[model samples]
Target: MSARTLGRARGPLKGSVSVPGDKSVGHRALLLGTLAEGTLSVRGLSAGQDVASTRRCLEAMGARFEDAPGHLRVLGVGLRGLKAPKAPLDCANSGTTMRLLMGVLSGQDFPATLAGDESLSRRPMERVAAPLRLMGSSIATTDGKPPVRVAGGTPLKGIRYALPVASAQVKSAVLLAGLYAQGETAVEDPFGTRDHTERMLAFLGHPGPLRSDKALTVPGDPSSAAFFAAAAALVPGSRLTLTRVLLNEGRLGFFTALKEMGARVSWERGGVHARETVGDVVVEHGPLKPLRLAASRVPGLVDEVPLLAVLCAFAEGESRLEGLAELRHKESDRLEGTAASLRALGAEARVEGEALVVVGPARWRGGRVETRGDHRIAMAFAVAALGGAGPVELSDAACAAVSYPSFFSDLEAAGA
Candidate 1:
């Protein structure tokens, strides 16, 4: 594994960063485009390895892709147009690609096996498999892990299912599979998820709200923007502008948490593009207080836990992240990994039940970061390195490419 050493910022991170396209939305766009009847051209798709994995898996199933200037034209094969892959589909490190594909493959008249890299292979797959099996797809995982095998072409009857956990990906999987099932397929998630898939379906002429425009322009990823936002929050005199970022209510948990922590954050809501709200956000460093982050807030900012954890370390009181059980199943045991990262950086952090507790303002004695091949972990610690007591060496920082390929470069540019 490769390593990189990041020092405390030369100065307060200043200037603007145009977020890469929202990967969660980017992933869905590619999947829905493949299922649509005609071509769907997407502009500003996230150039991340995870999204690339989705494209590769779809291509293996015979969906065609064409690259033009700033657009990816996906020639839709419709619902029944996907072909059987000659070999196992490799999803790399993207659980979104693997789990979502399980739903997409459920109705096909072919058997497909989805595999992933070592890290993804260890993450839970049965959460996606069990519900899929309930819908009549012959789906099985390797002892609740990856290498998910799906025998398609089963007669599916939809059932009203409740999500046991607040998982957008799982909800999306079941809903996607529901598209292939008979009868009315309904899912009730007590805690709602980002409605990208549902909106995409509607935009593509299904029965929903997102048909506001013909060409849907995906906005910048908030997840990627969180790193800089955290860095700016930690460093004094730091001010930054994040341009054209996704302002989805379901995805801005971090921003909400930031305001509660006393960060000077504001945004001008731009026009709605394809049912997604876009806006430019300005964040400035300010005094931060610890907030009791509850479980209900987890679904909105699940991906931003690492950055949040770092922020909590600099807060005056105890910051509790409730309902983080799902973090254990991510690319790494993220809850544990996050606590470990904080401890290395000289914070009092630990995991208690489903929540993570951090008592701060930490003594910022920096240390080495063990990424465990998790892209989020890698990126999170990189952000934590700024304004720390010493230099931080991150193992396998390249893992950030799984989501943000230019993470370090962008951080440098904005922090310069």
Candidate 2:
């Protein structure tokens, strides 16, 4: 059963919360590692059901896995070592799992079919499939939706492609397909996006040489750290440190936006892992001011928009977020769900074309929030509920389990 928010959090949210491991990396570690030689051991892995779908898909392709709570041991099948599944691969609610898996399957010799839940079935797969098709892989979709069929052994060859918009998943799909392609595959993002897949790929020893300085290269995911950052800020007197967060130029845009808006966020003990910036973040209560956003920084914080909206609700002044046109195609129209959730909490929000404007520190009262079955929306509202807004009841709270199965328990551990 779904849990209910009784009232605003009144006590000092105490203790340390080791939030789930990076969902993006956890998926990559399982999938890519399964494709490599030798055994792969993943620690602090996300137990989220969505990532689990990736693990299961890999296992179906001849990759054996022994999962122990937070630790997962996966046996690698070497390059091009996957076996065709006996049945269509069900991706559940994960677009990432399905899209990226297509890239992996594109370079193989056997056929595999990809399908998913209603939400995943509705997402556009054409973006990745078109690129894969260009690489000589024969892939078909039902009217640009899921239940995708792939006929492998297409002698894949890579080509440089420009992104119509900045999307990590699309870029990652192309890059992963490039792994087994005959030549170099380069993705040119005029507007850069997240590089978690790239960084983690490099960390695991298989990333292609990336050209930087023009784009905000993938930075470590502060998206995963956002919850604790908010927790530390809201918990009053709590000082929680987020260790080893990637600080790629593209990824740090969130921190930059938040800092500009007056959130008490900072980086500590910066280091490098396989050339990517790694650092810690410390957050405390501060008078958060409103921040302005536009095209240049939108792609960097795309995944964090929902949590950013929650922060906007608690900030002083009007927070403006623009260039969200792409948010429309995510698991749900995030722009609409975000604004609608704010309105449910008695806050003021509006959408102008692709931009969203939120007026903050408004009374967040009780109301029902329709999640649209998106994981981020489900989790974002959970953070909102801690504001003591009158009984914020969420419909489809189960959605959070997709990316963060223990989200509520972690929030509780942090004294929410």
Candidate 3:
């Protein structure tokens, strides 16, 4: 669809929903599985275009998947077995796929070139390349951007690198390279990013002894659940529970920020595997208070800030988001997109430095918003449409297909 309007709920929303698998984990699972020995099976894989890109690319490198009874069975070739692709690896619009895959491919013994769509091509890959280069990986790129050439089989050695910011993509890139390095690879984040790559690695049988409350040391991801959590929060009468979402200390700050702002959320301990924590979440209708998100906490919710901005519109007071300057360089200039979307809904929003301050509890007037081909921006605005003062029509709604193809369907099933 070119564009579509989300009808406003007359009253409180009610129902149950099962959000698709975590996007971050979906990507890592596919990649790690390809590097693991024997058969690996994945459940709750996200049906998003980005994750699908990784799947297809992996298949092209000689990995295979089987549709099994309860999961997708992946036959991994282990490290050093991946063959060079016949053509350049096309990552579509996924920045994570390109950046992290570059690290993984860097240590291999084949020459691989990674390319992407226009958006991905513009994203900076130099940050990742810097550390990979330190590991002795020969990486050549056009001014730190995509269409990157990595001559694999470099003599890589482990290095301790401190991130200038909290970015899971960079962290995962280093960790993925560590898998091929001669020594241990450690990435220290000033502020924590998502831990999905770390968590999935632990689950898949490579649990690292990483410290928490300071810097996470694993190779997993948790940013993937932010979208699903937002959907649960927006669907008023909805009472959906996701099974086995990782709750690393650094990543839990988003939920803490939400609770401080007064969202009705609860957790239940579930089974565990591969030394990673697993649990369930139940969200229901409740009053939401506004929150002042500082720069210190920005790394925790970096990927979810767009969705949280949508939540701010439904809150009781003004919400301020700081340390969001990193967003300027994402798939799109998300800070501008977030502000523009809030304006479309009649909420007062402005950008100061790297912070986004949203004055709200203002009604979302059903107006058309351009997503600028950013998936997070599209999905976040879609959630806001549920609370619109009128029906909200989002242009470029197709972008949601990149990370959450069934987002609308899932929301509808939840009675939104």
Candidate 4:
């Protein structure tokens, strides 16, 4: 673990920046490409540790990857061509890797075991495993968590399932396993989540047509764009342009929240890539009113809750973010972490049942905040530091490398 003190910006942040490729899209592309019938080429893949974990796991299963600067050419092994790994697949800290790969491994002809680092090991696998088990796959877990074991070669029967919770990972895992099932596999989420896997599958020529309401392209990660947008919106005189950002409706909850709060934000449509809509967004400093987010909207912006909490800290009046129980299971207890970070920076925030309430127009008195080994928490607080009263000391700042390898550098480049 490492620590750093981030100082407040001396002037308004002004610049244009291109964030790294979307982590969610990058992971799905590599995983789906590994199992596709022909060669697949991916541009602007994320160079982050979590996505790298997925690549390495796929390689362990005999998928060939030819890497270039900013691009990847994957020769997929066909749907049934993967060989069992000689050892247990180590998923490191990526829950997405572990959960999603369990689906891929379920239909193989050989048994497979998946394990991960401490943080990932604590995440519940049963949300994914229970459904896989329903598909006739022989799978087991240690008390519903990691160290998951799957006995492959079992024929799967696709069945319709309604998600108990709205989760892109669980939905994607079921859909991936559906590729090997005997019939169409369907998952319905009343509260929609990100659809990167579905979009990438369609792009790669999946035979079925998705629901009309679910059509998509896996654009740039709007969650990543939230950090920069916050810095520009909260820091006086700050004006920044984020290029080629994903405008997926399911992933735009944070931006919508900002707009509802009266932030000075606008966008122009750009071209599409990989079946994902892309656009350039301009954000500038402005007065933000309080926002009340409903529980139904939580799934769309679940990843951005920490950043939204930070933005709320600087906005006038109280902002209540509801439907955040899922945050308890992320890389960290993000709800607790978000509130702690805000309190450490002299803001008033607390959890009320499933909602996080922040009383703001905060008078920031910068102090040390713990990252708890969460990338989003670290990045959110770092953005908060840009408009703070003094230097904000962050413990375990390096954890941001998990999702955004160049986050600190990008922050500097944007003059934050």
In terms of lDDT, the best-performing candidate is 1
**lDDT of model number 1:** 0.88
Candidate 1 regions exceeding 4 Å error are 208-214
lDDT of 4 by residue, 32-87 (tens): 87787766767777778999999999999898988766557878778877988999
Clashes of each: 0, 5, 16, 3
TM-score of each: 0.97, 0.90, 0.90, 0.96
Q: How many backbone clashes does candidate 4 have?
A: 3
lDDT of 3 at 372: 89
Per-model CA lDDT versus the true structure: 0.88, 0.76, 0.76, 0.86
**TM-score: which candidate is best?**
1
Candidate 2 wrongly placed segments (more than 4 Å): 1-3, 68-70, 204-221, 235-238, 244-246, 273-277
The C-alpha RMSD of each candidate to the native structure, in angstroms, is 1.8, 4.4, 4.4, 3.0
lDDT of 2 by residue, 262-303 (tens): 657788647665446767776666667776888678888888
Model 1 per-residue lDDT tens digits across residues 78-146: 888899999999999999999999998998999999999998999998998988899999998998998
Question: Which whole-number lDDT from 0 to 100 does residue 317 have in model 2?
Answer: 86
- Winner on lDDT between 1 and 3 is 1
Worst 10 residues of 3 by lDDT: 211-220
Candidate 4: residue 373 Cα off by (Å): 0.3
